[model samples]
Target: MKKVRKILCCVFATVLMLSACVDEEIPNRNTPLGNFEALWQLMDQHYCFFDYKQKELGIDWNEIHDRYYKRITPYMNNEQLFEVLCAMLGELKDGHVNLGASFNYGRNWSFWEDYPENYHDSIARSYLGHDYYIASSLKYKILDDNVGYVRVESFSDAIGDGNISDMLTKLAICRGLIIDVRNNGGGQLTYAHKLASHFTNEKQHVGYVYHKTGKGHNDFSPMKSEYIEPAKGVRWQKKVVILTNRKCYSATNDFVKCMHTFPNVTLMGDKTGGGSGMPFTQEIPNGWSVRFSAVVFLDKDYQQIEFGIEPDITVMMNKADVLKGKDTLIEKARDFFKD
Candidate 1:
């Protein structure tokens, strides 16, 4: 019986060796880039929102999906995948179409993970509330000219109202108010309303959020201003100036949208980073958190303003201007009011 068992083991070992020699190689299925195409399709179909620009890309969505996806897939790292995805999405010139891993397998990450840091240059530091400000917090300052200035890094409600009120009060005392949304990645819409209420004494409709429903878009206009704020009764009611750049996004963009409704509001600097929607996050089985556009924003005119809000006063920053410690945009704004 022992000899027979030994013979059977020898025969099995020989067969396994032969099979191994002839076996086909299986591709690395877990490459982050390999999943790019699948990821995009999943996002398009299952994404909480649909962007009209997807159709406007001049390429078929499926074709665009297949081509760029094939180019990006095969990278084994998530960071690499993210880099490629960011580049690809930049083509759309819209901020609403964002990507993230689903939160299922314990992957908990915030959308502001890559939000720009507020270095708070000395001039900025003199005025902003630091300890309370998170990495995404907006920078509030009282400029040298008492032209109350607030550098909104992000549109987060987590930022204390005291900080917002403090600087807004300064702006109220100033000749004109300058709300800088440049490089602000955007956050909660409630914060947008909260910030806007400082400039608006009356209950005004800021913007409307729209989502894809059935065959058309679903409009979710947050017209019911939750005006629990009184601007601390420090009114900067004369002329309000908003400093916008390409990086001013999401709720910040919505804030600009609402500000546009007022005739006294003047937007200076570059065009805003256009994203006019509320984000909804979902968790996937892999513990990854994925965020999708859950809403779209439209102004009182019923225009679904997405690719970002265009500034009324277009100004660009020059390196020389920066070296001189001069904020050309702010200077331009101050000059505008002075004139």
Candidate 2:
């Protein structure tokens, strides 16, 4: 695990160095047109997924610039300018891209918002009952049929390696384990890696990551292979099911990607809400800051996960199951263990 961490750190350091070498010289002016030009130029130079998005979504960045440029008026108010800028950023169709201001944090959330939310917190909590044990942000309990259930609400908080080792130890007696990360919006990447490490007994190649090396839309650093080393502590030897939904995003998306590589781990439920891009923040001419995806992460097959990963078993929430206070995905995972 430490070796993996060091390698990832070096990769990030390389990205930082490469970013510093670029000459991004947008003028620092407060006017609407000036801010618009600054934001457009900044995204043009830094955003990493232009080529991918162009092919996938038919987004011609140059055409986008021409279309949005006409909307910028000298007499436009800050709100109007914000709307236009937000709309322009929306063209990328990325949840990682955002425009931050005092009044709002503009984002494109169609990744999850447009899909059927297959998760119900009430139903999930009912499965946990009132006696679940809490280890940091992990809420876990043994179900009636001896299936261990762990609900990870978010990765925003740090989940130490020790916490995970202990949690797994307590649930070690179960026939199988279910890791449910339904609505996790994501937090630190290290936390995601930490939880995923326990599932694999051997060091495994998980994916590749690369950052922009030049201002050109297609310019990028050579892909760096990402690996996940086996956890130094207790590892789950039994069949493990990871339940996901459209609400699972960012670091959680990365977690699903890693677990998909493990032989014992089966991904069940809806596809994850993908935000595979590593975002970087830069200030425009105005005081507001713009956040855009600067680094790209791909799965072990070198395929894009930015559009979400498909589960090994696709399960949807049934209205009848919901009415009975049962989580359809959780029940499906439990049935999987039985089979």
Candidate 3:
């Protein structure tokens, strides 16, 4: 019986070796249908919001494929093909999703389209005036009412420990602080997270992040808790008013999320442009780079923030106020800060 088992094992090993030596034909990646399949499979497997989107946005992935497949043809040009793919991706309505090529790129900006432009660079500059202090990338000045007004146009710029220390130290005597982030399109989340950390005294749970683990859309790893540890630098001790608007997105949106966890922080202005997904990029067979939200994040209570977060006070810039070169949101924040 042992001799027979040894003979059978040898026969199996021989067959496996012969199978391994055979060459397999790779799929054609240059064809239109081929590129389509690559992009489709990439999103189908890795997009983080499939399950959530189907439930909330009623996105039928299979149906989208069937509808868009007709647009692909063997004779279509690259531009024509790219347009079709962009149109297909537009259905997601997620700003984190994008397709980039050497010629042009695709994105969805309806998050702020048709919404009020609640922030103006000219107005912010007026508030800062000639003597406004500059600490690294931060622009700050004291309001007439003894409130500190800090306008952070974008998180794209980096801020350091010394920068925060200097800004906070100068504004320490103010009754309250206004962190205005309107029209801030967002960039590095590290800056936003680090900035938000200064408002809290202890470790804070801001949200949870989940990533894909399999090809199935529903397959996801367990949600990982996200925390913002208190900063080692100067922490603001006074009340805080975070001014936001429809233009605040990406890391800025996340900044608002983190601030929501703090008791001293109050959001005043328009709803944020929601873009909670953590983006991941890939290149298709045609060399075009495609990006999608590969991770899902929920608020501290496990709520979806993909649409956006609302401010405690929904303040808008009144036409009269704007004509007079005054920002209503800033004025409202100043009133809230009055002691």
**Best TM-score among the predictions, by candidate number:** 2
* lDDT tens per residue, model 3, 141-167: 998989999988888788887899888
Q: For residues 52-112, what per-residue lDDT tens digits would candidate 2 score against the true structure?
A: 9999999998999999999999999989999999999999999999999999999999999
List clash counts for every candidate, in order: 23, 0, 0
Candidate 1: list runs displaced more than 4 Å. Answer: 1-41, 48-51, 66-144, 157-166, 214-233, 283-288
Better of 1 and 2 by lDDT: 2
lDDT of model 2, residue 148: 97
Query: Candidate 3's C-alpha lDDT?
Result: 0.89
**Candidate 2 runs further than 4 Å off:** 1-24
By summed lDDT, the worst window of 10 consecutive residues in model 2 runs over 19-28
- Candidate 1 structure quality by residue, lDDT tens digits, 175-293: 77777777677778777766676666776665444454432332333443322244554444788898887677777878888888777899888776566656666433333444556
Q: After superposition, how far is residue 280 of candidate 3 from its true place, in Å?
A: 0.5
Say what the RMSD of model 2 is: 10.2
Give each prediction's root-mean-square deviation over alpha carbons: 12.5, 10.2, 3.3
- Candidate whose lDDT is highest: 2
Task: Rank candidates, lDDT, best first.
Answer: 2, 3, 1
